[model samples]
Target chain A: MSVEAVTAENQAPPKPRRKLRNYLLDPQFQMKYVGMVVGVTFVVASVLGAFVYDFSTSLTDSMMANELLLDEYQGSASFQQIEERARAFDRFVLISIILGVLSLVVALGLTGIVVTHKVVGPAYKMRLLLSEIGEGRLSLRGRLRRGDELQSLFVSVEEMVDRLRAEREEQIDALDRAIAKLRAGDDRDQALASLEAMRDQMARSLE
Target chain B: MSVEAVTAENQAPPKPRRKLRNYLLDPQFQMKYVGMVVGVTFVVASVLGAFVYDFSTSLTDSMMANELLLDEYQGSASFQQIEERARAFDRFVLISIILGVLSLVVALGLTGIVVTHKVVGPAYKMRLLLSEIGEGRLSLRGRLRRGDELQSLFVSVEEMVDRLRAEREEQIDALDRAIAKLRAGDDRDQALASLEAMRDQMARSLE
Candidate 1:
């Protein structure tokens, strides 16, 4: 591979694995987004509702004027027909407003869930990994699927564990060497002094 | 109190404590319930949508028949007017159906959230508590707000912790006694034998 290509490949992050079942992962994180969507829908519903109301009102007024003019000529059938039309229109407007709001809310809720899943899935995994590490399971590593949020968090945690493991290994190696020296016929006083010094260094390293 | 009343009171389960922020405590547990509601709403919407279509179709057919008769008699004004009314009513029905579906979806989505909160809240708390315990903070307790779901889970975990603490305390006491016996001027062999016995018992208890 070309040097630039190799550098680019090395810089690229690991790909995330696919999840088995996509359930709602992070309800808490998605709640605010859902709220915002619902709020916008509510506003839209209100505006549309007002428009429907105004349109129906104008239709009603026009129908009433037609009915009033027809009354002078004794056209009862036309008047009744106009009245029925106006009532039907009014009912239509009401239904439109209700359905519009409902559909909006459901759509928003589902969208929020999918979006939040990206965040919550990773969070749940991190929590489990952290718990294992906290229990002194230094072998445990953080891993997240592709498209998961908090990539930086995974990197930071892994780096922290790497440092801790390195320090612990070094301290253990020094202690082991000190004991081996004492056992291999070093002067008792000098060996004891060296072991004590090693102990202090171990303590300082831990700190 | 009357005997029957007293008996009834004694048999009744304890009331859940009241909480200040009395909303969305358990989302995880409520997931199935929310799904059911959404499913039912979808069915209802479908049925209502069909009804609206059928009703509007019938209305349109009647208006068409009337218009055909009026057209034959050269009553163009009446025919045009009837056609307009039918069109208006058709639009009204369409709007009503749309609004009905939208409103239902929104309402059901919001309801599902409230129900799910009751479950998700408690589940989240348990995760945190488990993490703490895994980190060796066994003294920490699992607590949920009033009226939260998974009350049994909290109780079970607390009992488990209680048993573990008791066992640990007993083991510590035994070790302390054994150490004290070894340090004090007891017969060396007898002290060692007793200490060994205590160690075996401690091991058995832990097992």
Candidate 2:
């Protein structure tokens, strides 16, 4: 066998990376995204609703806002008149508020689902990676979804795993040496201390 | 055994509630849900685009359209004369078109994200469930998200898993009987065969 191959065999595998979570898999981020969407949706819905209301009642005095395009505020109604208007629109206002609340709740639920998916998707990928590692399949290198916040952590994990793999190789080398000098799985209880002391010395010298 | 202890072991677990996804989680349902959102979004965007385009320009065009009100129809000059008048407000017309397209794109992107999230979230959950089962975590249950279209399939899978677990327990019970009857690992092969045969017979009977 080539000397290079022999050397390579003796070397520990690069440790797998330090463990990192997938960013998209993060429940928190997913929830935040969902919240943002819901907020935006609510704002858009409210604006659209306001516009529709304005269009429907454009001809009426009630349709127009008290603050017009002009600089001055229009105070057209007396207290009695305002009371009459309030009574007239009481039912409409109540119904409108209820409808708005219902819409908001529905939108929030939907946004929550959307966010949960984003968080869960990345999480699944992470679980898959972890399982691979647990099964001693460390050679598996796969791309996580880009822009995941957990990318840095994952990268660090991968590096740590690689380093650990290298250390494992070193440990195995030391074990092989001990086995070659003695017996495999041999009970060394009698010479345990002496053997370990000698082995440590040899390992330090080799390093 | 005390009545309470007997009840604890023998009492049946409450049937898990069926989610819409469990009730409906299927490829066909997924496609339908995605299709509905996609279709509605496309239709909404298209209609809104057209309306925004038509309404914005027509806001002023109504002046020209009302010939009797404008009184500028017959007395107006040649085609060039009308062209000149139209050109005066062409910038606003162009602006409206641009705004319409921008809004259309934004609307489409939002729709795409929402639909994608809905489709992929459950898929991720299913993936995790499969992984857990593969790793000998047979007791793991899938959590179906709300509004998932594969409810029936989820329910069916859950039932299948339960049946499988029960079958496994029966097999293990039979295996224990065989092992107990035998004295050594040397006869383990025969014991395993008998266990398998017994399991097969049980399966056939069930069928």
Candidate 3:
């Protein structure tokens, strides 16, 4: 391939850097969002926990009553035997609830990190690019990591920079031609005409 | 105030709109997020429900056995009386669980809307402004609603546009002066020198 093609390819915005260190550039913002996720998850877990405790107590009472009625009618084994079985089941259920809540908390926390990272990372990249552009660096491009939110906004910003660069080049080219006409010892009328045309071109571009 | 001050104020970017209608621009993305919230909540509820059922059955069995042992030893009461109380508690607990889960679902759904709107609304505004800038309307500014998530990024973008507008005005002003010098019947040598200087100024601005 030609050298021009290679240069153009090289100039294409680099694939967004995805170093692990850079991924959490806006940790405070991400943290606030994650906290919201965790808050919601906690609400669900706590309410469910209350419901489980109450329902378990009620169901256990009924089961014990039925066992006693059977024992009294049939004159079966001692009450202690039935009591042991019921207590064991109670311990098993409580353990299950504890494990379930722990798993939910961990899962939600991880998901919160992944979701907020997509937003915060893109916002951080865009802010840096805007600052560079503000400082008159027209060649810099806006790029976002893959899976970032606001892809359309990034594309529009890149196009805005391209237009600004193109307009600047056009203005400079017009000025160059006007300057050359004056230096070439052109007649007064011709030189004046060139300058006016250049002026008009610049005015039109601003409009 | 001077007219210039008033003009400057007028040119200052308008405050972004914060209408409620505009805030839900990307409902599809927001819906997917809300769906995830609901899914996680559902998992926690289901697990808790199973645990409650097992635990309640176990505890009830033990309670009935103990009560039967007491009655046989002391002739305290009948099994029918205990059965009524157990059924009453079961009904109360089941109703409470139903109410608890319903409230949780509603609360989570509302939270999902609020969290997703904060993200979606800002992204929508930024995208719209970038498109206007891309189309050569450099005077247009980037503005965002207050309390938006990416406020810093939006401020940077607005400043970038301000810089672009100022540079364009400066270049046009330089071109106008050079044009006027060429037209004013000035010495040809002086006019050429001025044009060259204007060209350099434009070049520097682009750089």
Candidate 4:
């Protein structure tokens, strides 16, 4: 391989740009939250929107009634102006309600995903590492993102693996000494074989 | 102890009512989400409230201007009615904005805590278990609540611990066989001592 290629291979791979699916590492967990917040906001907005509608409608009706009472005293141009203004107010309220609810859902949904990703992303990575450990591989080789939740948990797992690796080394050392001592003794082939088997098991686990 | 008390001791303690502190198991993590959702909602509400205010004010101003034009044609009683209606609409809009934003914050905040709690609670419990495992206690106990996030991750850790315990047992079994064989061989005392030491180390890790 070229020197630059080898150097690149030795270095950690470049971090991937986070995809939409990545932000939703645990969608059920995140969506349950987003749904509740958006749901509540929608209800609240609807109630207030209704109140604004009712109040404005009353104001418009009373204004129209006044315009009707003055029909004999006022021009048709004035009546048209009042009716047009009421319609404009109603249209504004309708637009506000639709736009308000739409933006709230979008904002809350994005926040929910980003927030839950911090917790779920690290957990997803740790679980993969953990399953490897379950399969007898103690040489763990990954880390959580800097801002991920559960950093302390990840550290504990790393420490546990380190301790396991250290304990295995000690067991192997002791096995080596025992095997050496057995080699010097008479008719010790069987004991030496067992010791070697135990060492090999420990050695395999370390990888 | 009475029979009832003894039974109670053997049984798992009653699950505590989830406290506010428990819901906020990781305040910094949970709040970042709640704050973002609430902040966005607040900003959106403010912009829409401003739009509503501007729309209403222009409508009221035009009506008031019409009332002034009609002043020469009508009595002060009609003018009073239009002005009062305009002020009421203004008051209603202001109340809607305040109440809407207040309730939105309250609703989103509660939802944030409850939702993040599902993920954080399990993680918090698992971290404690992991640290215990780090200290060489492979016999894990306790489980995540049914609705909690990361159930699969918890299962993986449990499996890893079980594997480690099983490996330790096999290592101990091998050591036992080696020590027995060494006991039968010449000049085997030193070898037996090393084998016994290795077995003891493996046995200690199982706890």
Candidate 5:
């Protein structure tokens, strides 16, 4: 095979890899992250709840004491003033209790939601993706839940896979054609040249 | 195409839809299943906790009532007996409270572990698998968690795919040979016969 023929075959355009569908990163551990959150929530809520419980007890006692004083000293103050002050104290405890309870509930719910979405939700999604890959759907692309590191990682891997598959396919195709021409009894020189060129191309593409 | 060639090609293996890798059922959704369990666990634990709180209140009241009776009926009962009964009641309450508290703690822990394994663990694993898939590892078999329908499903799909890919490669090779022979003009009749056989095989395999 002429050197020119060899060079021409070697220079055949590389085929783009099939966009690889990545199934990397099990995403199963998101459950652990979620578990951590649940654990933390319980701890935090317990601590905060204990504080609220203590504060409520103290406030109730203090208000009751103030009530006793107000009743005993009512004659010294205007009725309106005494009543207004008592009302204000009552309102404070009531509001504090309400706020504390509401905050605790809100925090708990948010923690649950955050944990579920961040961990549980992704797990379910990963299962879906793995199944897709298992089904021989190599063309699948992983879409991360949001613009996060995880998502970036998946996307980047998928992109790399695609490049690799494309390159591989190109070499395989070139090898196939070279083999076919050689099999068809093209002049021995030309076929040999093509074979050498295809091999070089395959190696380079692999690299 | 000769009858012999047609028969040879037609004898090729069958094909399948959606290659399965293992015996897992919906292997892709295993993580989802785990997440669901975790979600259910959290919900159940919260509910149980609420019940525990209510039970604690009722139990405390009952203990208090018993205490009051002990005090009020002191004259009827011997001092020692009264003390003994009070102690008994105290022990009962203490035990019940301990059990209730223990249950809560245990339930919380289990929920964490379950959520961690199912939701978090799978996500990371899936990410890795996907990454590998993305890296052009077409032969990657999604690892199946043990003793689940998902694993079975994965296996089933993988098997199907393997069979089909093998069949396709075989057909491609035969087709190439037939075409090559036809082009060489040495055995056009035989090549044509082989082509017909391969076509038949392809049809049967797809079915």
Candidate 6:
């Protein structure tokens, strides 16, 4: 195989397609917010729906009274027409209530997921990076996506890692000078070896 | 003064009552999420309101037609009754529309703030703590609140800080041993001073 082909094969695998669950990177955090929004919507819808139902029922009762009065006048045509309009109004109210609640739930649920994702995504990434740092892996290869929330926090973490790396590098350099200085003295090999080991350990931490 | 009185004076100030603006610790981040939620609600409400308005108008027209037919029958009492019902229906539609929109906005907007605050609060605190670490202040005195989002991430950060603190302590201990071993050697004053300075610097970082 050509060198370029071999290098391509050795590279990191392509990211997998995001599944539905992928959007909920932190379900515990995301769901709490989603529940809050959806709950509020439900309460508001219920209260308003009740008011509308009461108004609609009273209106329908009054219209029925008029229908009876017209019946006495032998106005069959007007009675049928008014009855049709009443049925249409009832139908409109029923359909509206059902459709309105459904639309609100769907719209708000999707919006909650999207909005919470912005915060959870960066936090999830940062937690992974932090655990790596805890294990002495000072090399921060991953970065938060653009437009992610917590950009400032991520930048601060990056600066912290950079500062740590620089300090380790300085320690290694100091060990190098100390080892060189002790080389000419008798039985200095033990001290030199110890310093070298420390330097190597510090250098490995940056990898 | 008694020691207890002096200690009380030296203690941190009492937390002030949270103001309206205090909830918006990170306005830029919080508002974007709030805007997305409110915008979706507005679009849904607008579409639904339009549908309701059209249905109401058509229903009103049909009722008016019925009203004129009753008028021709010389039924003044029935006419007035029908007219009053029609006016009442119109008023209900108008009030419902106005009230529905207002309630949805208020409820959703408050939920947005509270939900987003859970995420933003921890992120803001972490940024402050991370910057302190970058400046060699390894002491992490702040903590996330109960019910806050990003609790796992906050724990991971605490672990990272603890690990870093331990590593610095180890480095200082090694320096102590090195300085003690060199104390009896000929012309070891320079080496001892250098090691002591390094140890002090490492110790200070954990302060």
Please report how far candidate 6 places residue A77 from its true position, in Å: 6.5
Better of 1 and 3 by lDDT: 3
Candidate 2 C-alpha lDDT tens digits along B8-76: 889887588654444343444344444543344345434544554454345335323432222342454
**TM per model?**
0.43, 0.34, 0.68, 0.78, 0.38, 0.79
- Model 6, retained fraction of real contacts? 0.46
Tell how far residue B55 is off in model 4, in angstroms. Answer: 2.4
Query: lDDT of each structure?
Result: 0.55, 0.45, 0.68, 0.73, 0.46, 0.74
Q: Against the true structure, whose DockQ is highest?
A: 3
DockQ of candidate 6 against the true complex? 0.29
By DockQ: ranked, best first: 3, 4, 6, 5, 1, 2
Candidate 2 lDDT, A23-132, residue by residue in tens? 23454545554565555545554554454344323322322222121112334455556445534544453456346534543544453554345335544555565444
- Write candidate 1's Cα lDDT for B1-207 as tens digits: 899889888886757755423444543334444565556556655564666456555646655664555456555666667777777777786777677567756665665566456546665676666544443344546478886644554554465445544544543454444334434635545544543454354333222
Worst lDDT run of 10 residues, candidate 2 chain B, spans B62-71
Model 1 segments more than 4 A misplaced: A1-22, A25-36, A63-77, A187-207, B1-207
Q: Give lDDT tens digits, candidate 3, residues A1-207.
A: 999889878897677786645556677777777677778767676767756755564565556666767677667856888778667656766677677667766766666666677777777788888788777777656468777877777876787777777866775676676667766756656756765776666555456
Candidate 5 lDDT by residue in tens digits, A1-207: 999888879897767543211222223333344445455545644554454345444444444444445445444555566457646645654554455444434443444444444433333454465454334343445566662223433554466446544644554454455445645656545644554554344333223
Better of 4 and 6 by lDDT: 6
Best-fitting candidate, scored by lDDT: 6
Query: How many residue pairs clash (N, CA or C atoms closer than 3 angstroms) in each of the candidate models, in the order given?
Result: 27, 33, 10, 0, 78, 0
Q: Which residue segments of model 2 deviate by more than 4 Å?
A: A1-207, B1-90, B97-105, B134-137, B141-152, B184-199, B202-207
Which candidate should be chosen as best, given TM-score against the real structure? 6
> Candidate 5 at B121: error in angstroms?
5.2
* Clash count in backbone of candidate 2: 33
- Docking tier of model 1: it is incorrect
lDDT of 6 by residue, B61-150 (tens): 665665666677865656667677777778779778777977897889888887777778888898888877766666687889998878
